[model samples]
Target: MRRTHSLRTRLAFGYGLFFAAVLVLMSAGVYWLVRQALLTEVSQELAAAAELIQQDFAASAGPLPGFFSDPDVLLKSLPPRLTELDTPAFYVQVSDLDDQFSIGSASLRGQQLPRTPEDQTAAMGGSTTTRIFPLGRGRVIQLSAPLLAGGAVVGVLQVAQSLRPVDQTLQVLLEGLAITGLIALVAAVRGGVWIVSRSLGPVNEITSTARQIFQAADLARRVPAASAADEIGALADTINAMLERLESLFTAQRRFVADVSHELRTPLTAMRGHLELLQRGVVRDAEDQAEMTADLLREVNRLTRMANDLLLLAQAEVGLQLRCAPVALDDLVLEVVRELRPLGEGVAMRPQLAEQVAISGDRDRIKQALINLVANAIQHSPVDGTVTVALDQDGESAYLRVRDEGQGIAPEDLSHVFERFYRADRARAQRTGGAGLGLAIVQWVAHAHGGEVLVESALGSGAAFIIRLPLSREQETEDRG
Candidate 1:
């Protein structure tokens, strides 16, 4: 198995590594600059010393041969600082044109400084050269220049200085940089961890809340809000909204199951009672037996209707597909009104329709929707009241309205009238043998046909349910043109 590190650890480690790389590069650059500056200073001093020695040699001796002829006189011409027995400033050496050692500074203590062939050749060519090489217990910077007599190269003057002081300064700087970098790296890693953890704190809280909800099977719980409105906060808000929707859906599902069970139980109980009465021969008269059989048939038909309505609702919830064809809206309205007029009993049914209003939709589904609306309106109409079915059209859409003279829906119940199995008056709905799914089916049919259903009602007044469906494309085009 591959091991994974936490985001906080990864971020902190990355931050520390980046800082370390920058620190190392900066330290290396600083060390290089300082070392170069010190070496340049020493080289400058060596050049100056060599120049002064040459001037003294030219002043004290008349010619190059005479200068090399006497070692004691040459020694006397050297700088006093170079001759000091206690901690001399520099080591000096002189060599003749033949590459023979001629004289040396007292600081050398009779010790001859080693000369490289390169330095000797440069001196012979009259080109001054400087180099740094290891000596005794430390290092030194040496400058070699040609000695001139009568403007001719006669000998070589070499000057060198110890680099112990510069080394000590650089060593201290390296130690300081190392210690400071280590401390800063540690601080940076810790700070990065803290910042990353704080930023992801809300994510952890949301995860914990979701875990609890899953374990407890409770969708009511929500993720806590974050302190700041950043990306994490937005995520928290989104999760809470999802939880709210899930809770609503779950609540509706439970209610739908209960409503379906009750609706089924009522018919089943009545049918069973009637079947037992007939089976026991309690209805000896043919008329009584026939009535009991009719009651059982009625219950069965009600159950079948409820089952079909439930199936239609299920299809609507998944996504209902319609068979498209040109449908005459006025003719469909008139047919539905004629079929349902007898069911209204004492209530009058009226059809106020416009002419030549057609739509593109499934004919059967449109008729079913019109039938549901007219039936619902007739069921709700008062005794001897009028149930008006009206159809009208505009440039883009057709309107089908079903109005009934009855006690209108309350303000609070109007919004939820199209919800499955919802009834404002449960007792009245039961007395009428309604499953309370008619309005829902009507709403779904309207939506499937690219339309919407709206209701307008007030207390003690009648209610008007209007369905608005888009007109057929060809009809709309012709009208527009």
Candidate 2:
């Protein structure tokens, strides 16, 4: 299935989201710290301005204009201009019960300020108060103090300052944070996207390799391995392993088809030739007809036996059997030799038996393997030639050697002797009714026992076929472990 996800986009989004959240939280903390510091400075300045207005009102001792003072007389005592004030950079405005005055504002020609009876009473009753003033386009903080007349309420002393300094400082901080935040976000997103792309590149290569393989057909594709020591490299290795197995299986299947067809063609041609001659009335007598039928039946039997052997070899190679308990190798070998004694007729037989030789195996399959090997040796030996069957056991393993004084295999054909349907001589194969699966089955048997079959021979010398098996159940277990 195809998916609609981009590694670059996903990486960028993840980094942007997480770091964006952190930036917001950190920015909020910074803003809170800045606000507290600004408020502390403003509070100190407000307290100072309130103390200055209180001193001016105490010197005058004027009556408040209204119950909630108009701040009229408080303004008159204030200086007409604030050019000589301690904080000339600030706009110092004043108001009390008598009048209002703007000492330093270039923009506040007529700005009404906040004043209430509660605020006035709070300020006059031995306390100070503060409030906010909303001018048209700006804002200010105002603090009020009380003027005492013989320990009773006289008038309020008001002092106000414009909020420009705090606003300017906050504006500068906001601009810097915005720029820094944008730059950091850009760098983080770029790095994350690049990393994700590089990491996912191998995945794309895997997809491309997979696409090269055919669907429901022949196998001929190889996955390329990346030269990295990472998880992606491990994935490449696994894919390559699977592809190798598939290629081997396909090659074996092809070779099996060709070999089977080639082996069957000769027997089938002989049976057809015999049948054609019998049908043409050349075999007019009953004995001749019976001989023709026997030839046909022999070829059919040969075909069936070869098919069965190939099937057994295939099953063994594929490991299709379950294991069982220990097999007494000595008894098994002697029994197999007795069974094949009839086939060893006309050839002198000698048997050397071993005792107490046990190995883990399947009894019937192992017997079938030995039967094929002994039969092959007897059939190939000369009349009155010696066929010796010997069994020996060692500390680790058991060995069965079948020796025959026959024409030894050619050096070139010896290596391929165990291959399916491979015959050393076509003339010998015709006389023995052989399809060449006997030794193949023996090889698989050796492989199943976790051992091997060794064929020792020279050009004119007799051949000896050696079969090796595990010694005992304990030995097999130790080998496996």
Give me the candidate number with maximum lDDT.
Answer: 1
How do the residues 262-378 of candidate 2 rate in per-residue lDDT, one tens digit apiece? 778978998989989887878789998898899899899999998888777767767767465778767877787778888877887777885556788878777777888788889
- Predicted structure 2: lDDT: 0.74
Q: Of the candidates shown, which would achieve the greatest TM-score relative to the real structure?
A: 1
Residue-level error in angstroms, candidate 1, position 362 = 3.3
**Cα RMSD to native, each candidate?**
6.3, 8.9
Worst 10 residues of 2 by lDDT: 99-108
Candidate 1 at residue 373, lDDT?
Answer: 79
Error of 2 at 315 (Å): 4.7
Q: How accurate is candidate 1 locally (lDDT)?
A: 0.85
The alpha-carbon deviation from the true structure for residue 132 of candidate 2, after best TM-score superposition, in angstroms, is: 22
Alpha carbon deviation, residue 48, candidate 1 (Å): 16
TM-score of each: 0.69, 0.59
